[model samples]
Target: MSFFTSNRFQDRQAAAAEARKAMAEKFLSRPKYDPNDPAVKEREAKRRAVLEARAAREVERERRRAEAAAAEAARLAAEEAARIEAVRQEALARDAAENARRAEEERLEYERKLDRDARYAARKERKKKAKSPFERYR
Candidate 1:
């Protein structure tokens, strides 16, 4: 038989026997991993660190964006409130000025009526006096 054929038969039979023995073993054993392999544990650690840094940076960026949005909303609310307050104050001032003007006009009309009534009463009394004394003498 050729060397390769002889080796393949032997390897297969041995592999079968080993698999059966492993199944019958009381406790299973884990395969040995190389601790000192150049691209093994170091590469995994670097990849994990990169993922963690990216996660932290994303969280920080989201927090800043949220803060900026909140500040902008607050500023807009304050501006709207100030504008409403200014409008209210202007309306109140206008109402007060109109009330004062109306009151002054009513006072002037009352004074004119009182003066006209007094003049009319005095003229009637003078006419009565002149007629009474002169007609009796004649």
Candidate 2:
């Protein structure tokens, strides 16, 4: 088993060395370019222009997205403010109605008390009149 394992490791190392050699040869065989060549310069300029255009488009898109977000936020804030104002108005109206009801109840109670006092006074006056002259002398 040990011998087989050592043999497998050596085989893997040999294969890796062969792969590196092949990669190096392939890289060297690729076409070389001259920096001063007009074709090379043109290709570089085209690539740079494309990259700049893409960046500009991205910036514009981001600006529009930010504007949209701000508009949405403002709209939501306005809606919330309107809702709050409506609630406040409703509360005020409720309070006014409650006050009116209380006032009406107090007025009714006062009127009933006045009626009872008048009836009591009339009864007392009748009793005094019913007493005769003899009762008054006693």
Per-model TM-score versus the true fold: 0.55, 0.72
Model 2 lDDT at residue 127: 85
For model 1, residues 1-138, the per-residue Cα lDDT tens digits are 576565677899999999899886734574356768766789888999999999999999999999999999999999999999999999999999999999998998899888888888889887777667668789
Off by over 4 Å in 2: 1-15, 31-33, 133-138
Clash count for each candidate, listed in order shown: 0, 0
Best by lDDT: 2
In TM-score terms, candidate 1 sits at 0.55
lDDT of 2 at 44: 98
At residue 101, what lDDT does model 2 achieve? 100
lDDT by residue for model 2 (32-67), tens? 998898989999999999999999999999999999
Which ten contiguous residues of candidate 2 have the minimum total lDDT? 1-10
